[model samples]
Target: MNVKMNGFISLVLGIGLLHTASAATHSLKYFYTAVSGDIDYPEFTAVGLVDNGQFMYFDSSTKTAVPKTEWMKREGADYWDSQTQGLIGEHQTFKVNIQTLKDRFNQSKSTGVHVVQRMYGCEWDDDSGATEGFDQYGYDGEDFIAFDLKTTKWIAPAPQAVITKLKWDSNTANNEHRKNYYTQECIDWLKKYMDYGKSTLMRTVRPSVSLFQKTSSSPVTCHATGFYPSDVMVSWQKDGQDHHEDVEYGETLPNDDGTFQKSIHLTMTPEDRKNNKYQCVVQVKGIKDDFIRVLPDQDATNVVPIIGGVVALLLVVVAVVVCVVIWKKRSKKGFVPTSTSDTDSDNSGRAAPQI
Candidate 1:
């Protein structure tokens, strides 16, 4: 069941590693994937993200890296050409890595599809001048091996990766280079890009908060949209106190306009709803005010809903909850997994040593 569950979810979710939110903190990450089999996916692909926003993309088919955001067009063609050349080299390397992994897992002759993926990047806190980095690799929705900075060794959770771990860990110099690249080089690039997109990247937009229910007996949802920077928190409060139990937290998803949207659901009995004073509170990372939405004081048994959503996607919320819990549990067991995706914010972002 786990294998089937992972395979199915991996097809859709890239991998997400939630980070601590701060108004002044920013990130730069790269996600690369190489695939093997008769899949429709690109043989190799790459994406670059800044603060959860994809700024550039490359694929085997395009063979060139292109900016995704208008603000990133501040650079000349030479800048994109340089990025294109770099990804070309990495793409070739990943092609070989994918085949090597197929053989490593004894799936070279199998009809099944396979993928090799890598995510790495750096983060900086402008407010404190603090810096951090992460680099990890995954295969077929499971952890293969990852760099451990504290021990300066490679960790292999699956038996198949032990051999590679031994070989890679033997390269002390390369390990140090990777560490330095992530901590120093990657961060330098991040700051440069942040400066280039300061008007777009550094601005803060507060969310539009909405409290709605499909039906009186159904779960009430607190939805927030049109937010920038992607660090928004939504929670429910009961009788002037914080409420945690029987609540569901949704992912901060990207909107087409470059802003973000998020929702949280509350499940309460009809009796409890009548007895308690409830409100939904929202806070965007850099916003000064907390957006509050008080629940309508109506009988829980009332048939009409307060808000009308022609299309209610409750199943999406369930799927996100289940997938996150599963991968987190697997991560705790020392086996983190990820998907073959073009987007960096997929469900299974590799658990970096959080380095």
Candidate 2:
């Protein structure tokens, strides 16, 4: 009976040890929140170590006596190191003590895990080729980091020095003032970063569209008002297709409210007046797309006054022409009788022998 009991006890211990080893190998190594402007640390507990890897502690930050192994294992070092060289350095190593790392994990309890396999030194650019003295760190492609209860190993974040957003504004009365608006190029660059997982969000103010009249004789002019100018794309579309190379765009204006505004002018021609349909599409980064149409009704209304004035002027001109024609006819009849009288009088005098 004693021998049997000993064998059962050994088997149970072996199973327990194997389970612990498995748990430790896949633990979470980091925790963080990407949101800024709040408290520095998370409100929950996290754990990490060189030997056991990294894992999350499910208990709240306020709780004591939480089991470390029971915390979720989300990421390992291998995943983090492969995505970016932002954290790699020749002298970089996991120099932080395990106890210190644990204390940091518990102190800044976050709702998610951010595990990094390696950290490296980097320089900060403040211009002038000068760098801040603080040692910067990033993850090599081999490092793994994550947050929350996610099971997949996460790629380490990119360098913190990247620009996240750009703002543009224009003060010109109507986008009539031609200038190169860098807003689109800026957005394209930001998108590149977003595609690479470097930025979390892109934000900006709405952009404005304006229409101006370029023809002196044409009184049909329209203006687009009340658009915010930050982080927006202004484009002109004619007849449902994009008018790319032919159309000219204006400078992106900055508004006092930290937004952006811009305008464009198309010279109204007989052909344009005839077709009479145009559209301006504004695409704001991270916001819904907006489109404003210049319908036939709107265009007709704008041209109505000009048409009325032209019609009135034409009537006056025709009335003057008619009056001139009538006067010329009457003058011709009156002058013909006078000339006939003179001719008759002269002939009678000649024939009456000097009477």
lDDT of 1 by residue, 217-282 (tens): 789888888898687778999988999989998667666567777888999988888788889999
For candidate 2, lDDT tens digit of each residue in 202-278? 23334444444434434332333334322345666678876554455543332323233444544445666567566
lDDT of each: 0.68, 0.27
Off by over 4 Å in 1: 1-18, 37-39, 298-355
Residue 264 accuracy (lDDT) in model 1: 89
Give per-model TM-scores: 0.79, 0.26
Candidate 2 similarity to native, TM-score:
0.26
**Candidate 1's TM-score:** 0.79
* lDDT against true structure, model 2: 0.27
Q: In model 2, what is the error at residue 304, expressed in angstroms?
A: 10
